[model samples]
Target: MRAALAALLLAMPAAAQTGDLVATDALRVCADPANLPFSNDRGEGFENRIATLLARALDRKLDYVFFPQVQGFVRNTLRAGRCDLVMGTVAGDELMQNTNPYYHTTYVIAYRRDRPVPERLDDPAMKSLRLGAIARTPPIDLLLRNGLIGNARFFPLAVDTRHESPGADLMQAVADGELDAALVWGPIAGYQAKVKGLPIALRALPTEAGVARMDFFITMGIRAQEPEWRRRINTAIRDHQGEIDAILRDYGVPLLDAEGRLQPP
Candidate 1:
């Protein structure tokens, strides 16, 4: 009886540890429910696809936490423990532990094909040229800091579409002569421009501001103390880079090479 009891006590901890690693308990992802080309409740977006791939690689199942992406996404979803991971995080966001980036998208200067591309927003010829850009995106911030606001014309937000996706319309608005040029998010802007066959050229600024490197990237994020989770995510990103690229490509997202030009394949 004593010998049997000792074996049972030894087995309990091992069993408990094993139980803790089940698929359903392993992955918990946070995403905005209505954000498209990124994530949503239906799991049809690129981020959702990538999350599924990551979960599959980790041999786990995903559980999602949906929330609005306003000011509270990080605090409400990440900090509140609604999920374990935050997809598509910007570099240096203070709240979470960000992993090494697996990919990058360029910040391009998009303009009508017939119009000469401005050498820089500060160029003299660009002074009277009207431009459209999202409110707080990197390029917009750069233009503001350089005092390029004279020619900058803010596009009025369509009250209903602002939350769902403001990029598509913003790009279309530029193509329709609603604005001369648009400083927009790379993927959405490029994808829409390509889809519309709008004879617009995407030019990499001679020197991009805000991010010091041309190879600016974004990464997956985990809770700050969860080093183990971070390691797992980073390993998955490194190991499954090819798969990641394929997913991005399927969405028409232009992934840039080290030179900041779009990769051929």
Candidate 2:
């Protein structure tokens, strides 16, 4: 029986490569070709830079499969074996298992600098202020849950107004004085607002549990069955911290510490 089991184990296709990862060949990465500062096939995104570093560490070439950043990208690529790993992913995203977060991001309130900053999201002073937010977005949901505003006054149409590119519009509205403020992804929002000199102040809001915030770190996703691959990826993250930091820095994505404060690049 022991001999039979040993034979079976030997015959099984290796779920993930094992042993010294430095000797490994290539890391198949799933990425989006057009997304900036993330995974893109043009070899310009942060995820792409990190992928290159990881490949070098493992002594492997990188095999990137580009796809749009849309629903089912994970299922169709990484899950279906078209790619071995996802370059980056939200930690608690419902799609796949993730490794320890290599970095965290902040979601800040971007408002006209001339306007009064609310002490908190529920502050009474904000009661009459028009805040632009993306429809079906987490921030919008948080606002609704907090009873921050009525459905009619939200913007770009109304509180229920969803847009394919709401973040861009939301920032533009704030710049144009169409809205007093908007809650958006910190890195992207901060970058755009700063580049445009929109005269906006990006402030981190105090958030309650379960809402995505600067305090929570995001992680990289890997195939669940590939424990060895996951370990190598995590190891690469630790070993290439400086390179990763630089990549994010170049893209204007602030690296946040455990307390959610921006850290020095």
Candidate 3:
């Protein structure tokens, strides 16, 4: 029976095998080709810079299997064997085993410097503002629970960000006086505000009673079968801490410490 099982396992597809999935010649990355601040075909995003660091540390050529970050992204890229790693994923996501978290961030509400928003989502002031939040993200729940969704605008997620940056656009709306405030992911809001020089201000959403999580730890994703590879990459992350932090800093990512305080430049 042991011999039969060994033979059966060996006959199964390579991806199903419990083995080191790291490629010998390259760091094959699964990335969205047009997702700015995260990745793109032009290799211009922070994840691309991190991918280069990882490839160098592993002594492998960097290669990317470009795909849009749409439904079935993992199924089409990593699990389909087009690549061996995803550069960024929310830690604890059920779809992939995660590496040690590299960064912590939170949702932030952005508005024009002159237009103030309620610090807490449950504030009664929220109900009066013309707010915008992504349709399916955490803010929507808070927006609804506080009865603030009446005048709130909902933007769709998973668009080709190269063509449509809903988060940045919403921030722009705030700066242009089209909207009162917009709650969005921190990195996008910070990066866009800096790069675009929008007259917008951002405030991190603190943890609140009876509210959904506003913060997340981000990690690289690996196949559940690739524990060894995960360790190797984790070591790479430790070895390149300064470079990684600098890359994120360059991209204007809003980083938070374990206690949820913002990191200063």
Task: Provide the lowest-lDDT 10-residue window in model 2.
Answer: 155-164
Candidate with top lDDT is 3
**Model 1 TM-score, 2 decimals:** 0.79
TM-score of each prediction:
0.79, 0.78, 0.89
* Each candidate structure's count of clashing pairs: 0, 2, 0
lDDT of 2: 0.69
Model 1, range 1-265, lDDT digits (tens) per residue?
Answer: 9999999999876555423322345588988887666877899778999999999998887899888777767888877876888899877778877988977886667787887666677677676777877665566666766677766766544333326467766777777877778876666766665544676767664345454343358898777765556677889999999999988887766678887677753
Clashes of 3: 0
Q: Tell how far residue 37 is off in model 2, in angstroms.
A: 3.6
Q: Which scores better on TM-score, 2 or 3?
A: 3
Q: Write the per-residue lDDT of candidate 3 for residues 85-203, one digit (tens) a residue.
A: 89879989898889998888889888888767777777777778898888889877677777888979888887876588777677778888989988899888887877667887888
Q: Local error of candidate 3 at 90, Å?
A: 0.6
Model 2 RMSD in angstroms? 5.1
Give me the runs in candidate 2 sitting further than 4 Å from their true place: 1-24, 151-164, 194-198, 209-214
Candidate 3 TM-score, C-alpha based: 0.89
**What is the per-residue lDDT of model 2 for residues 197-222, given as tens digits with 9 covering 90 to 100?**
56777776556777645345768887
Between prediction 1 and prediction 3, the one with superior TM-score is 3
Q: What is each predicted model's overall lDDT from 0 to 1?
A: 0.73, 0.69, 0.84
